[model samples]
Target: MKTLYIVRHAKSSWKYSGINDIDRPLKKRGIKDAHLMSKVLNKMVDKPDVFISSSANRALHTAVIFCENFGFPHFNLQIKRQLYSFSDGYLVKTVNALDDGFNSAIIFSHDHGINTFVNEFGNRPIAHVTTCGIIGLKFKEKHWKNIRRGETFLVEFPKNHK
Candidate 1:
């Protein structure tokens, strides 16, 4: 069976007022939350075979921290620029294009799309997925393209722990 972990990028800082939305860095709270969530998932969730994240600064930073904590190869993570669009349809297309070599994948991106996609593919309803939030779904099928709304195996975020 294929498995997927949908992750919302950690909170971003607006301190750099002139920076574009795509270039905002993480806030201090975001950094801590990312660390905590990474550690938590490292212990509880199965390792993902692939790691994909939006090329935006905030999401990319979160994915880097997660890869370090999860022991995933740093170079293996793909920074996709299109994921920044935050569109569920685009995200699904991205998933469908994934190679079958990996049975599990970690997809990190922004909200609205992540939130919408999760509610679509996840059995449990979510009002919103907080920064650094992670929801794990277990697909009944073995192929990525055949994946649909499967079982919600885990729903975790930093607030729940701290």
Candidate 2:
């Protein structure tokens, strides 16, 4: 079995009006929530073998915080522009390209994309994947390429702790 974490990028800052959406950084609340979610994930299960995120600033920052808490090196995180898109098929392709040697992975992305990605691999209907939320899925397939729908094992949202 292989495990995957579908994470919504942490809350972003709207403080800078002229800043591009892709360039927007995490807000203070986002930073706090990232740490909180990381602590929660630390107790959930074995750490993911790899971390991946959209190259967008908010998503990448969120991934970095989570990877730090998970004790994963920065070099292990993969950044893909496709992850910023809401295309479910593209997200699947990204996951399919992973090395079979890695048993688990965490993918940080934006709202609609994160929501769509989780539903692809889960039995439940997740209306929204809130910022810093983590949805865990465990597939029966041995290889990432064969991963399909599986049991939704976990759902952790920042509000749940607040």
Candidate 3:
């Protein structure tokens, strides 16, 4: 079985006027939500074999929080620039290319892409995946490249917990 965890980046700050979308840092509330969700997941699930994130600032920062909570090495986290794309095509490509050696992986990315990917890949239909939300899927397929629709084992969001 292969487990995949998809996380939408925490809320980002728009306070900075000239910053690019990829450079937008998390707001204070975003930081708090990341911490809370990370800690919560730490208790609920096993640490993933791989952690991947969009090179975007918000996504990377959110991934960092979860890494710390899980006691995973910061250097082990993989950052992919292609994951920054808003299209689910990139997300699908990134996941389909995952190493078969790893049984589980977590990916931190943006909205529309995250939402679209989950709806396509997960058995449960999710209308939306809010900021700091997490969805855990378990695939029966042994290889990532061969994965089809899988079971949604978990769904966690900041609002539901708060």
Candidate 4:
């Protein structure tokens, strides 16, 4: 069984002027939500074998919070520039390329791509994945490349907890 955790980055700040989308930092509420959600996730599931994140600041920061909550070393977290993409094609390519050695993985990324990927690859139909939200999908296939729609095991959002 292979488990994949897909997380949409926490809310980001638009307060900065002339900052690129990839460079935007998380807002105060984003920090609180990341902490809250990470604690909730920690209690719900075992730590994943690997944690991966988009190189974008917001996504990387959220992944860091999860890593800290699970005591996964920061250096062990993998940052992929290709994951910075906003399209599901890139997301799909990333998942398909995951090393078979790791049975479970977590990916922190942006919205449209994350939402599209989950809806396409997961059995559950989520209208939208809020910031700091987590969607866990389980696949029956042994290889990541062969993974098809298996199960939507967990769905958590900050609003539900709040």
Candidate 2 lDDT over residue span 23-117, tens digit each:
99999999999999998999978888889999999999999999899898999789999887866776788888988998988888877766777
lDDT of each: 0.90, 0.88, 0.95, 0.94
Compare the candidates by lDDT and give the number of the best one.
3
TM-score of each: 0.97, 0.95, 0.98, 0.98
- Report the lDDT tens digits of candidate 1 across residue range 11-51: 89998878899999999999999999999998997789999
- Tens digit of lDDT per residue, candidate 4, span 1-162? 899999999999999999899999999999999999999999999999999999999999999999999999999999999999888888888888999999999999988998999999998899999999999999999999998887999999999998
lDDT agreement of model 1 with the native: 0.90
Q: Name the better of 1 and 3 by lDDT.
A: 3
Better of 1 and 2 by TM-score: 1
Ranking by lDDT: 3, 4, 1, 2
lDDT of 3 by residue, 1-162 (tens): 999999999999999999899999999999999999999998999999999999999999999999999999999999999999998998889889999999999999999999998999999999999999999999999999999999999999998888
State each candidate's clash count. Answer: 0, 0, 0, 0
Give the residue spans of candidate 1 off by over 4 A: none
